[model samples]
Target: MDYRNESSDTLRNKCAACYRQFNKKEHLVEHMRTSYHSVHEPMCGVCKKHCRSFESLREHLIGPLPKAECERIFKERGCDICLSILGNRTSLRAHRESCLSRPNNNGLLYRMANLGIQDELRIDNSRGRVVALACKMVGGGSDGSLDLCARVCLIDEHERILFHSYIKPNIPVTNYRYEMTGIRPEYLRDAMPLKNVSRKIQEFLCNGEPIWQIRSKGGRSRILVGHGLDHDLKCLEMDYPAIKMRDTAKYPPLMKTSKLSNSLKYLTRAYLGYDIQSGVQDPYEDCVATMKLYMRMKLSQFHKKENYPLATDPQNKNNFASWRQNELERMTPDQLLDISRSDYYCWCLDSQDY
Candidate 1:
C-alpha cells in the first residue's frame, strides 16, 4: 500500500518554476503565485525546466546527478553562452561561432566622409539605424562621488563610429580617473558643448520623425543599443522612448546568475570570449563590444513563440482556471510547460517580422 502511494505521488503535477510537486493542478497553480517564476529565470531548453539561476541551470545541464535524458540532449545541442538548444549540430556550430566571436572594430573609423555630409555614419539595411552607444565619465562633486560625462561614442551595427566626442562638462570635474578613462582636463577644454552634443544625438536618434512616434514599432526612429543606457542617457541629458532601447545590462538573458546586471567587461569576455576595458577604457571599444552582443541576441534563431506570453490576447489566459482543473491535471508535464507563459519579453522576438 505504501509503495502504491509512493508511485501515485510520483505522478503528481509539478510547478515548472520551483519544481514543487503537488497532488492537484490547482495546488501547483497556487505555488506559482508566490514562486515569482519569470522569463528572467534560467530555463533549460530541452525539458523547459526553469531554474532560479544560471548556476542551477548549468548544474541541471552538466553537473553531477543531472537529468539523464536532458543531459544527453543538451550535450549534443546546448550553447555554452546563451544556453539555447539548437535544432541540429550544424545550427549549433553556426550559433556558437557567432556567439563567441572576438570583438572587432573593422568598420570605418572617425572621418569626415563625403566632405562631412555623410555625418560620420555607416548605415545598415535595417528599417532604421541601430546604433550602440558608450560613454566615459569623470567624477565631480565632493569626494569624487558624482559622474560627469566626459566622452561619448556611438557606433553602427558594423561597428563604425557614427559620432565620437569629448564633452565640456557643465560643472567642474574633480577626478578624471585617468588610469581608467584616459581623459585629461585638456581633452574637454575645446570639446563640444553639452547642449549641442545632446541636440545632435537626439535629432539623430529620432531621424526626423516626431519624438512621440518613436514608441510605435517599425517607425523611422533609430533603435539604440548599449549597456546601462539609462545612466548614459541620464548623463547626456537626453530622453528616448523605452521601446526603442536595447540595453544589454537590463536584458534578461545576459544578466548574472543572481538576476543582477552583469558588467559590460564581464559580458564581453564571457559571451564574446575576449577582454575589454582592461586598459584605459575607450568608448569606441565599449561601443563595439556592446554592438556585437546586441547583434548576437538580435539574430538568435531560438524557438520562442510557444513560450511567449501574448498578454494582450484575451484567449491566452492562464491554463490553471478552475473550470479546467481536471483537464490540466491529466496533462503531461511537458504539456503543462507548453501552456506556461513567459513573464518577460524575449529578445529573440525582435528578429520576428511584424
Candidate 2:
C-alpha cells in the first residue's frame, strides 16, 4: 500500500519549461526563465542587452539592470553606426571609413566631428607682420580633399608655436591630391578642425602692429616679391595694389637674358645651386620664394631698359650691367620667372643702404 511509482520516487532532475536537465536549484531557476515566457528574459531595456529568455530571467534574476548607466556610457562613447550617441564622433567615423575603404569615399563623418566651428582669419597688429599660421595635417585623397582629422600646428612669425589642436572637419572634402601632398587619411583621423584656424590667425594678426607697413613707410612704392604671392594674399583675402606687388611672373628679364633656365628648379640651381622641391607648395614657402625673387631682381631697376643679345649673359660680366640695362626691359614673363629664381642679390645693394 505504501509502495509508489519508481519515477515519482526519483527527483525530477529535468526542467519543465525547456525540458533541459538541471540538477541544482539555481540551474532550474535560471533555465525556467530562459525556456519560459519571453518577457521575463534578462535583458537591458534601454541598451537592449539580451538574455537567455524573459521567463527564466525573471525567476533567476537577483537585481534589476541599471539601464540608465548603460545608456549614459553609450552616449559618452561615440557609436560608429549611430554617431549621435557616440562620445568621440571623429574616432567613430574614422573607424567606419576604415571599415569601408573605397575610392571617392571620403571619411566624411569623421570630418564633421573635428571641424573647427569658427573659421575666421587672425591678424597680429603689434608684430608688424602676420604671425599666426594654420598648420593642418589632413588625410584623404587629393585636390584639397580633407576627410580625416590630423595635427594642426599653430605657429607665430617669431618661430613660436602657439596652439596644437586635434581637429575634425565640419564638411567632408577628400584631399583629391593627397598623394601629391603626401597626406595620409589614416594619419589625420585625430587632427584639429579648420574652424579654429581663423581665430588663431586673427589673434596673430591683431597682436602685431599692422600689415602693409612697407607701403606705409614708402619703401619701393610696392613690394616686389615672387610668383605664388597672389595665392598667399588670397588665402587671408588681404589686398595690395599691383604696384605694391612685383610678381616674378610679371617680370620678363628673369626669363630671357639670365640664361639661367626659366624654371625655378634650374634657376635656383644656377643661382643658389640648390634644388627646389616640395610635396606641395606651402604658403610659407610661397612667401619666401616671392621675397627672394623680388630681391634678386632689384638690379633690373638699375638697367637702362633695352634688349641685349643672347650672348651677353653672365659670362660677359664686364658688360653685364650695361647689357642688362639694354636687354632687361624687353624681356618676357617667362624670362623674368627665370631671373627671379636666383639668389637675392638685392641684399648686397640694400647693404650699401642706397
Candidate 3:
C-alpha cells in the first residue's frame, strides 16, 4: 500500500471512508477529524455537532449518556468521571459524579466492581459498537489455567488470526508451587522460541488489517475479535484503537467477569458451553470459540427489535432508521468470516450509528 511514485495521475491520499486528502499528514489527520469524526469519536447530542478536538469532546459529554452506556465506559477507566466521550469507563463516572447532571449517586449503579462494563449499553447512540471488527485474547496455558504459558491471539472481521506467544517471564525464572502445572517449565522445557513465534503471526496477519486501524471505525464494518482481547493486545505493545474491535470477554453482559480471558477454554465453556482444550489449545479451536461466541451474541441481538432501532421501522417506513439486518445463518464458518465492512451498519451493539 505504498503511495510512492507510481504516477502523478494516480497519486491520491484519500481518507479510506470519505475519499478526502491533503499534502501533509497533519492536514490529513485534521480532515479525518471532521469527515470521520462521527465514526472516530461521537457528536454532541444537544448541539448536533462533533468533538473538534480532545478538549472539545471533554466539554461536550459532561452532561449525560443513557445510564446504560455511561456505566460501560465508567468501568474501563476505574470509575472516574470522564468528559471526553472517547476515553475509557472510569473517566465517565468521574464526570457523572461531578457534573450536576449525574443521576442519583445510587450505590446500586455505582458498584466499585461493576465499574468494568455495563450489562446493557446505549445502542445506536454511538458508532463504537458497530465498528468493532476483531477480537484479542491472552491464553493462560492450555488446561484452562495459568500455570504454564500466556500467548495473545488477535482475530479480525475477515477471519484473520495472529498470535504472539510469550517467551521468558519478565520476572526472574523461579519455581513456584503451580510451577509444573499445565505448561510447567519442566513440560515446556525450552523458551517459547520468539523468532519462530513472530514469523507465524506475521504470516497470519499478512493479509488483514492492523488492530488499531480495525478499531478506528468505532462500529461493525471492521471487527477485531477474541475473548479478553484487550489485555493481550495491550501487553503485546500495540497501539490502541479508538474503535472497531469485538472483545467477547469484555463485551457487555459477558464482561462482568474476565477481560475476555484471552482464555478461549474458559470463554467457550462460559459462553458457548463447550470445552476448548484438553492440554494446550489449538489455534483453530480458539478461533472457533471466538467465532461462536460472537455469533451467539449477534443472534441474540437480532431478536431484540430495539437492537435495530434505526432500521427503517418496519411498522412505519416513512421514518427510517437507515440500516437493515438479517441473520446470515446455516452458512460455513468461512462464509461468516468473509463478510464485508459495508455491512457494518447491520450489527446491533447499540441503537444509534445505524
Candidate 4:
C-alpha cells in the first residue's frame, strides 16, 4: 500500500479503445464486454473529456454534478442548452445580438389580425390538421425560479401563421432574458395580459369544441406540434390532450442512440439540413421547424401499420420479452424483420388510417 513505484498506466486501468481510465482491471474488462465504448464517443467541447455517449457529454456539461471550473466558465460564455462555448465576452455579445433578434415584421398581433382573416385559426380540412406552438420565457427571480411566458406563436400545418402575441406575465419580470427572448420592458408594457392570451390559445387549439367532447366523441382537435412542448405549455398555463401531442423532443426515432432526446436545434440540423435557434429565438421559425419535423415523422414509411397499438400495450410485454431462444432461432429473416421494435408509439398511428 505504501509503494509509489507503480506506473500511472498500471494504477489506472485505461481502456485501449475509449481511453477511459478505470480504478480496477475488472471494471475495464466489464466495459469492454459490453462492446459499447469507442473512439467515436462524444467529447466535451471545453474539457475534452471523452464521454461514453452524447447523454454523458450532456450530463458532464449541464447536469447536477458538472465539473466546477467548466460549469463556472460555461455560465459566463456557454449556451446552457446547446453547450456551445461562445469564446470571450465580445464574441458572446455578438452572438447574443444576432441570436435574440430574428428578422421579421414587427407588431406581430397587429399584422396577423388586419389580414382580413377571422379571429379563429382557419384549419385546412383536406389535410391532417397540425398546429405548432412556441413560447418565450421571461425570468422569474434570481434563484432560477420558473420563467413566465412572455410571448406565444401558433402556426398551422400549411405554415400559416395562426396566432401570435406578446403575453404579459402574471408576476413581475425579474429577468427579461433579453439575449435569448428578445423581449424588452417596453414590449411587455402594452402586451396582452396572460388571461387573454390563454383564452385565445385555448379557443384556437380546441377549435370551439370542449376538451371533454374532443376526448369522448372523437371531435376535431388540431394535433399539437412543438419541441419541449410540455415546458412551453406549462409556462403558458395551457393544456392539450396527451395523445394529440407530437413533440419533436419526445419522439423516439429522433432521439439519440442512448435513448436521450436531442435538442431541437440539433434535430433541425440533422434531419432538415438547416440551422435554427442560432441567435435570438424566433417563435415563428420554431413553429415551422417543429411542424416540418412532425410531418417528416408522420409520413415516414419505417413504421408498419400492422404493428399498431401492440408497441405500446403493456399487456404484450411478457409475450415480446419471453421469446424462447429456439423460437427466435427458428424465425426467418423476413419474419424477424416483421417483429415490432419501436421505442415509442408511432405518431402516425393516430394521424393516418392503417
For candidate 1, lDDT tens digit of each residue in 1-354?
A: 697876576556666555768776667655553454654456788887888655567778888889899889988988877777889999999988877777564322331121111246423334346888998899999888799998888878877667888899899999999998877787788888888788888888888788987663676788889999999999999999988889989886677653588899888876777888876777878889888888876675355554335433355565556687777766765566556655555556677653
- What TM-score against the true fold does each predicted structure earn? 0.80, 0.32, 0.34, 0.61
Compared with the true structure, what per-residue lDDT tens digits does model 2 show for residues 1-354? 433543432235343323345444344433332232121122432343333422222222222553455545444553322112333667656645543312111113223343332232333233333222322334445565433333333333333334444445555546524543334454445544445543454334334334445342233222224453354344333445443445454343344222322555444443332344345423233333334444444432232221221222354233224445435434432232223212212222321331
Inter-residue clash pairs, candidate 1: none
lDDT of each model, Cα atoms only?
0.74, 0.36, 0.37, 0.64
Candidate 3 wrongly placed segments (more than 4 Å): 1-171, 175-181, 184-215, 218-222, 255-267, 276-287, 303-353
**Ranking, TM-score, top scorer first:** 1, 4, 3, 2
Error of 2 at 133 (Å): 9.2
Q: Best by lDDT, which number? A: 1
lDDT of 4 by residue, 1-354 (tens): 634634553445565443566655555554443433322234566765546444566667777898887777777887543345777878877755543323234324433442222244543344346788888788887653678998887877776777877888988888888888777887888788888887777766777677766761256776789989889988878787777788888775466754578888887775565677876777777888788777755653233345334434565343334344345434432333234234345566665453
Between prediction 1 and prediction 3, which has the larger lDDT?
1
Better structure of 1 and 3 per TM-score = 1
lDDT, candidate 3, at 78: 25
Give the C-alpha miss distance for residue 236 in model 3, angstroms: 2.6
> Which predicted model would earn the best TM-score?
1
Candidate 4 Cα outliers beyond 4 Å, as residue runs: 1-128, 143-145, 213-218, 257-259, 300-303, 307-309, 313-318, 321-337, 341-343
